[model samples]
Target chain A: MPNRQITIAELPTDTLEPRHFQLTETDMPKPGEGEVLLRVILMSIDAANRSWMRGATYRDAVKAGDGMPTYAICEVMESNSPRIAKGDIVAAEATWADYTVTKAHKVQKMPKVEPLSHLMSVYGIAGKTAFHGLMSIGNPLPGETVLVSAAAGSVGGYVGQIAKALGCRVVGIAGGAEKCKWVEDELGFDACVDYREGNLSKKLAAACPNGVDIYFDNVGGKILESALNFMNERGRVVCCGAISQYDTDTPTGPRNLPGVVVVKRLRMEGFIVMDFAHDDAKCVRAMQHWVSTGQIKVFEDIVDGLENAPKALIGLLAGDNKGKRLVRVGADPK
Target chain B: MPNRQITIAELPTDTLEPRHFQLTETDMPKPGEGEVLLRVILMSIDAANRSWMRGATYRDAVKAGDGMPTYAICEVMESNSPRIAKGDIVAAEATWADYTVTKAHKVQKMPKVEPLSHLMSVYGIAGKTAFHGLMSIGNPLPGETVLVSAAAGSVGGYVGQIAKALGCRVVGIAGGAEKCKWVEDELGFDACVDYREGNLSKKLAAACPNGVDIYFDNVGGKILESALNFMNERGRVVCCGAISQYDTDTPTGPRNLPGVVVVKRLRMEGFIVMDFAHDDAKCVRAMQHWVSTGQIKVFEDIVDGLENAPKALIGLLAGDNKGKRLVRVGADPK
Candidate 1:
């Protein structure tokens, strides 16, 4: 059988054009002694992909020309390790490819949960980023106001649900009415402010009358400014992502920041998820418990083909995806 | 004896003209119950006086025309309260006036650990401001590197000493050779960087090779930017005053801040000593202990007479004062 693989051919420019991705069919290699051949089932699409394309974010941190970064749902196609036998469902850091092989340590055993796609999503890096941002940086207490920007998306959805479950008054800020409704009614956010609506600052203030205590900032332009204005004294702002500013050639600084932090005594910290990679098991266990108890909801916006990965990623950045944007590559052998 | 009172007859614009202050000789009234007549000795001349003259800083948070705010060393001329008696030396809030009547509660019993002038100098607001900025906001831990701007001044002098006593590697930024040598030798700073000599960024980086863990910022602008650049991960910057920008009509913000805080997770907080009035006793007691043990040295630049108050304050803003700048309105009776 012919194996398939993906390669980083050309880097994307300022704008991530469709031509940036060069798809070529190549023969996949056999598994080493401790390796497992994974038949890629689903691949996640994230704003972080834009950084991978531009060759900026991970250039110095991680090696260059490392096969395009991705997280994928897979099945053990073949394995030398007894831990993951053929046909065992798993999740691994693969690529925008159909089949790939990695060491057993790299392959995580996806737990049997309510929704299988969640293993590649709400229980994935995106989810963990939000979880850590909330738990460690946020330190949200019961009855406190928890404000989340990009709140209808993957990490935002989980963040809202978790804060709600933790007894916080969760408020979300998204681009449209549909996203706002989903955040309020589906994820059970106490209120959702549509940032696209005129007078976002006033609307956000009205939505969070008591003022924001914990701000999970994903969009970091005007939304950040609005949240800063609404923050209560000694508020915590977790800078998990700056999706709004990520695409620009040059990022804009927070103008009102000095006054904001000074007047309110606020704490705003930016962090990478891998900083808390040591606490993976803790995050997974807590998320699993929440899933089993039905206290949290996981949503995946699945696109059915590996060929559509680039478009899916583009759509994800455009706020077109409703939840954890997933590109279905192949069938899960399980 | 005729009682004389001083009033802000006119507001100052660009400079302190004679009309800005009005002296009126009034009849000396009998001391009311629980009040004492304070024969003003030493008065604090601070840039905060400039703000007090403006009647506001950022907003109308601190209104102007509050009878010219000053912290003074005074002799109790007469007292009706049992706690305070005539001819006792004390520290109280007196204006730019020669004699002012204040309640016994408004006065603190002078500690004999230091000279009456030194106590009214370092142990007063200027010194307490430094202590609070270092311990509370800057939070310099043992063996950490602390960078203090305006090192030879009242606040910065105490900041270097406190940080040194706490086992920190202290670096000072001052204008001239005299100030720099005084900071390094007398204040016990590990090194002193002459900010007036050359490129502040390069100098600061060289001075703090290990990176700055805490920055006690009195001189804002370029010093702030330099301090921000050399900040280690999780560094804390305490903005007690922005003397570097105090003279300007509109203060300039540090442009390099976003890059600094985002990369190092640095926290910059502004504080006023009055905000900690609830725990003022704790601060005073600790300072008193430090003073008595010779662990901390107090510096005073005393200008004799009430008439020289304006010139002394102007000299303070011009960076003339060697230590805590005070105006001796009258001699200490004790």
Candidate 2:
């Protein structure tokens, strides 16, 4: 069978638009000694893709003419490992391709959920990033106000739900009314601030009456400045992503950053999910339990076809997606 | 007796010159029920004086007509408290006055070193800030590279020595050849990059062959930008003070900050020494031991008389002081 792959043609100059990628067809290859033939089902679209396109993002950089970097839900079509077999579905780090091969160790066995697409969304890198950042990095205390930027998106959404679970007063910052409403009304966040509104600082201050104790920053710009200004003493800012500044070559720094950090004694740390990859099983187990008990509501914005993967990522970066932006490559063979 | 005091006549309009202060003589007040009358001996000039002059520096802003902000070494002239008595020398939170009063708890018992002047330099706020920031916050590991800005100054100097004692390779950033040489030779730092060199980035890169693991930042601006650029994975940048941006009405933010934190998985925290005030006993004890063992060195650039204090402070802000800047307000009681 022919394998259709989205490969990087060149680096982004003006913007991280879809034109930077070239969708090409290649011949499928046989699995190696311990590798599994993965039939890609669903691929995740993330701001991190922009990082991979430009340079390295905590891992290897995606070079020109290379397969575009991705994390996807896949099925084991063929395998040669003692631990794996055909027909098992899992989440793996594969290319933006229909079918690919990877070592069994690189893939995680997916637990049975209503929609297996979650294995790529909440149960995969996004959920794991939020879990590690909250638990290991932020560690928000009970009744503390947690302000999450991009709160309606994948990682930010999970971060809010988990903070809510931990008895925190969760406040989310989304771009529009629809996303903000979804975050507050559906996701059970205490309040959701529309950053598109002019008075971000005033609105944020009003929302968080006691000042922010934990700021899960995904968007970095004037919004970061607001959060930094509004942070209480010893506040923790978990730097998950900077979707707002990802496209710019020379992004402006937050002018008020250093002084506030000193005065408030704030701990601002940025981390990659793989930093706490050891906590994967534990986080997945807890998330599954939360989802099962109806305490956690998972939202996904799935775009059909692998052809739209680049567009989906571009839209995700631009804050146009409602929930977890994902590209459905093929039907899940369950 | 007449108490001559340096008080701010008005806030800084343009420059922090000596003329901004009005040295007025006032009647000496008697020790109240719980206050001890302090005969000021040594006054410490710091970058934080600039902060106190303009706005709050983890404390209330100094008003226009108020006694100029200061931290001084003093001999108790009279006392109404059980812990303090007349003629006993100590350090207290006093104004830039020949004689002042403070509560007993606010004054610390002076530990006997070779030179009692260290009570205002190595054992005072600068020392404590460096100790707490390096040990409690940065937590530099053995063999790691610690890059300190303003390395010839009090806090940054201490940071380098202590990091060196902890088995870390310490590199420093100073302005001129003289200061850089002093930082490297006298302070025992591995290398001191002269930031005044035309290509600061090239010089810094050459100094720190391995990326910076811990950055003890005092001068924040282009130096901070360079440090942010040179930071290693999981690096910690301790924001102690922003001496470079202190005089500015509008400080330019480090444009490359938030992104580097994410990419490097860096932990950047800014803090005041008062936040770890409880750790005073532990730090003083350790520092005394280090001093006795000759593991730590004390350097002082003492200016004569309280009249030179405003000048000392202005010069300190301008990076004119070679070491710890202090004013010999009066003769040492010992």
Candidate 3:
């Protein structure tokens, strides 16, 4: 069988476009010793993918002609190691491809669910990221206000819902009026501000009358700047992602940082979801409870076909998707 | 006795000069009920005093025609409140005046020490600030690389020495070759980089080859910008003061902030010494031990007379003082 893969055509110096990636087909290969062949099922599309191309961050830098890295759910088609059996569903560091080959130890075996896409949404990166960044970094107290940017996006939608589940006042900042309404009405946030509308500081101040105690920042730049102005004394700013500045070469930062950080005695910290991988079982248990109770709503925006992966990411960067965005590459195991 | 006072003739829109203040003779303040009449023995000049004129910070904002506020060592003349007694030495919120009248309850009584200025330098605000910020915020571990800015100045001098006493590798960034040399030879830092010489990022990288684990920031702006580039993953940035931005109208912030902060997983926290006031005795105990063991060296730059108070502050902000800068307003009790 032929394996279709999306590869980076050229490194983006400024804004990334669909043309930056090209789809190519190659012959499928057999698994080597201690390795397993994976049929890529669902591939997670995140802002961090765009950031990887910018340069090396927490992960290795993506270069021209490199397969786009992704966090994906795959089925063990052929296993050479005794640790994994054929037909076992696992999660691993994958690429925007129809199939992937990795060491058996590198893949994490996942439990079966009614809907396999749930593994790519609530039980996967988006839900876990929101849980960890909000709980571990933000450390939200009951009744405290949590102000999150990119409210309608994958991790952010979960962040607000999780903050609400923890009995905190959750407010969101999304790009437009439609996203803001969905964030407030569907996600059940206490308030949602449209960043596209001017006077964010005033609007945020009005929405958060008590001031923000925890700011879960996904989109940095002007939103982060405005959030800094509304933070209460000794507040925590969870620096999850800087999607606003990720697509550009000329990225402007907050002009009042470290100064406002000093005056307010604020604690601004950052972390990757992988940092809390050891606590995954614990995170999953809590998330499962919230999901079952309906306190946490799961919304997976799935795009079909491997060919649309580039377009999905580009649209995601432009604030197109509403929830956990994933690209379905192949058929689910029946 | 006539009280000679320095009042802010006008608030500076940009750089503060001696001409912004005027020395005037006023009637000595009398003790009212629950108040004490204090003879200001010595006044501590700090960069934060200039920050106050810019706008409100941890303290109230200073306006035009207001007396320049100071942290001072004083001799109690008359006490209306039984909590404090006459002839007791105390530290309180005073001003650039020979006499001050404040609530007796607000004063902290001090133990008599020879050269009383030691109470203003090592055991006072400068020492406590360095202690609290380094120990509490920076959380320095032994054998860690600690990078401090404004190394020859009041708080920075003590910060480097304290970090040294804690068995950490301490590098300082100061202005001019003389100050840098003084910081290395006199203050005992591992290395001192003169920021004025240009190419701070290169020099800092060369100095801290192990990479900076904790950055004790004092003079924000470009120094902070350069320091962020050299911070190791999971580093801590102690935001003590921003003297560089305090004197200027147009203050530029670190352009890579919250981005570098995210990628590095750094914990950049800010604080006021008063936030740790409950642990003052503990801080003083540790500081006194360091001072007695010769691990911490104390330097007091005493500028004589109340008239020079404005000049002393201006010069201190301009990086003229080598250590804790003070203005002597009245004679110490015999």
Candidate 4:
């Protein structure tokens, strides 16, 4: 069978676009020793993917002609290792492709869930990222106010819902009025401010009257600056990602940093979800409980077909998707 | 006795100048109920003094025509409250004046050290600031690389020495070759980089080949940017003070903040010494031990007379002082 793959046509010097990616078809490869050949099911589309194209961050830098890296759920078509069965569903470092061949040890065997998309949403990177960044880094108290940016996006939507589940006053900052409304009404956030509307500092102040005790920052730049203005003394700024900066070459940072950080005695920390991989089992248990009890609502924005992966990422960068965005490459098992 | 006082003639819109202060003779302050009349012995000249004029920080904002506020070692003249006795040596919030009358309860009694300036330098705000910021915030481990800015200055000098005493590799960044030399030869830092020499990032990288484990930030701006680039994975940035930003209206922040902070998984925390006041006793015990064992060295730059207080501050901000800068206003008790 032919494997369709999306490769980087050229590195983006400024804002990322669909033109930066090129779709190519190649012959499917067989599994080598200690390796498994898998059919890519659902590929996670995140802002971090755009960041990887910028330069080396937590992971290796993506270069021109390189297959777009992604966290994907796949079904093993063939396995050379005794550790994995042929039909086993696993999550692994994948590319924007129809199939991938990777070492068996690198792939994580995933448990069967009713909605497979849940593994890409709530039970996967988005869910675990929101949980760890908020619970561990943010350290939100029961009555504390959590001000989260990119509220309508993947990790952010879950972050607000999780903060609400923890009995905190959750306020969200999304791009537009529609997203803001969805974040507040659907996600159960106490308030949602539209960053597209001017005077973010004043709006944030009005929304978070008690002041922000923890700022879960997903989209950095101006939003981070405005949030810093409303942060309470000794507040924690959970530096999750800077989606606002990832797409552009000329990224303006928060000008009030370190000065405001010093005056308010703020603790600004950053982490990758993989940093707490050891606690993934504990996280899944809690998330499962929250999901079953309906305390945490799962929102998945799934785009069909592997060909649309580039467009999905471009749209996601433009703040088009409402929740955890993913590209469904192949059919799910009956 | 006539009290010679230095008042802020006008607040500086940018860099502070000696002409911004006006010295005048005023009537000696008298002790009211629960108040004590203090003879100011030596007044601390800090970069934070200039920051106060910019706007309110941890302390109230210093306005035009207000007496320049200072932390000083004083001799109690008359005490209205039984909590403090006359003739006791104390550290209190005083000003650029020979006498100050403040609530007795606000004063902290001092021990009679051999060199009175030792109390101002090693055992006072400078020492405690270094201790609390590095030990608590930086959380320096032995054999770690600690990079401190303004190394020859008050707090930075102590910070480097304290880190050294804790068995860490300490590199300092100071302005000018003279200050950098003094920082290395006198203060005993592993290496001291001259920030004025341009290409700070390269210099810092060469100095800290193991990469910076903890960055003790004092002068925040370009130096902070340079330090951020050299920070190792999971490094800690101790946001002590932004003296660089304090003196100017158009203060530029580190452009690579939160981004570098995220990629490196760094923890950048800020603090005021008063936040750790409860543990001051414990810190003093540790510091005293370091001082007695010759693990910590004391360096004091005593600028004589109340008239020179303004000049001392201006010079200190301009990177003139090699250690803890102080202005002697009155004679110490015989």
Give a tens-digit lDDT track for model 1, residues A195-241. Answer: 88779988887888899999998877667877888888778888777
True contacts kept of 1: 0.15
Worst 10 residues of 1 chain B by lDDT: B57-66
Error of 1 at B302 (Å): 4.3
**Model 4 chain A poorest 10 in a row by lDDT:** A249-258
lDDT (Cα atoms) of all candidates against the true structure: 0.76, 0.86, 0.91, 0.91
Q: Give TM per candidate.
A: 0.81, 0.96, 0.98, 0.98
lDDT of 4 by residue, A109-178 (tens): 9987867889999999999999999999999889999999999999999999999999999999998998
- lDDT by residue (tens digit), candidate 2, B101-167: 8888888777555576787678878788889999998998999999999899989889998999899
What ranking emerges by TM-score with the best candidate at the front?
Answer: 4, 3, 2, 1
Q: Looking at model 1 chain A, report the run of 10 residues with the lowest lDDT sum.
A: A55-64
Q: Indicate whether candidate 2 or candidate 3 has the larger lDDT.
A: 3
Q: Of the candidates numbered 1 and 3, which has the greater DockQ value? A: 3
How is the predicted docking of candidate 1 categorized under the CAPRI scheme? acceptable
Q: Write the per-residue lDDT of candidate 3 for residues A166-214, one digit (tens) a residue.
A: 9999999998898899998999999999989898988998999999999
The CA root-mean-square deviation of candidate 1, after full C-alpha superposition on the true structure, stands at: 4.5
Model 4 misses residue B6 by how many Å? 1.3
* Candidate 3 or 2, higher TM-score: 3
Considering only chain B, what TM-score does candidate 4 achieve? Answer: 0.98
